[model samples]
Target: MALVKVQRAAQITLPRQIKDAAHLAEGDYLEAELTSEGILLRPVSIGSREPSPEQETEILAVVDQERKAYAAEHHR
Candidate 1:
């Protein structure tokens, strides 16, 4: 187990060991979730942005339409 200290700004410097273990780099995006156990930090893909549910549905609908079109085009 590693120990971390919170700085004056309430920011904690992630230990080098932890960073290396997590394969984290500068400018990397992380998602933090607080739970009863502790804080969970997950590294996310760079440039990943959350989309609203409506946007997600729209995106999926577009993909489904494209796939159907492609299947229809290739069908015998």
Candidate 2:
């Protein structure tokens, strides 16, 4: 594990090894999760927008298809 110190300005520099492992880039958003073990950082996409109607339909269709498949396999 790599160690990083927080600067006086309240900024922590992501380590080079961690950066390469996570494929992080400048301006990328990261979410910090605090757990009993330690702090976890995860990359997340942030935006303000609604899903397109077509995309919503497609997502529902995919979920329905998966449910059908699951039922067929387990209901046998």
Candidate 3:
């Protein structure tokens, strides 16, 4: 349904719609597998360690921005 071109480092950026549908974020982790059908990507959350203060701050800022955007769209 969607197409993505692989970049120089064999990296592909998921489209915004796909990312939102999967509830994925910038720092989220994913598991990749080669299945019988095709490549499969599964989002995985492995909390190995706590985020640094700066990372936490950046995450909170992103969350706040997304919340505001959602609220505006939903008239909340």
Off by over 4 Å in 3: 48-76
Whole-model alpha-carbon lDDT for candidate 3: 0.78
Highest lDDT scorer: 3
TM-score for each model? 0.55, 0.56, 0.61
Please list the C-alpha lDDT of all candidates, in the order they appear: 0.73, 0.72, 0.78
Over 1-76, each residue of candidate 3 has an lDDT whose tens digit, in order, gives 8999976434689999999999988878667778999999998765633567887788679767866775687675
Q: Report the lDDT tens digits of candidate 2 across residue range 1-76.
A: 7789976434589988899898887756667778999888898764423446785587569667866886787679
Say which candidate scores most in TM-score. Answer: 3
In Å, residue 54's CA in model 1 sits off its true spot by: 21
Q: Model 1, which residues run further than 4 Å from truth? A: 48-76
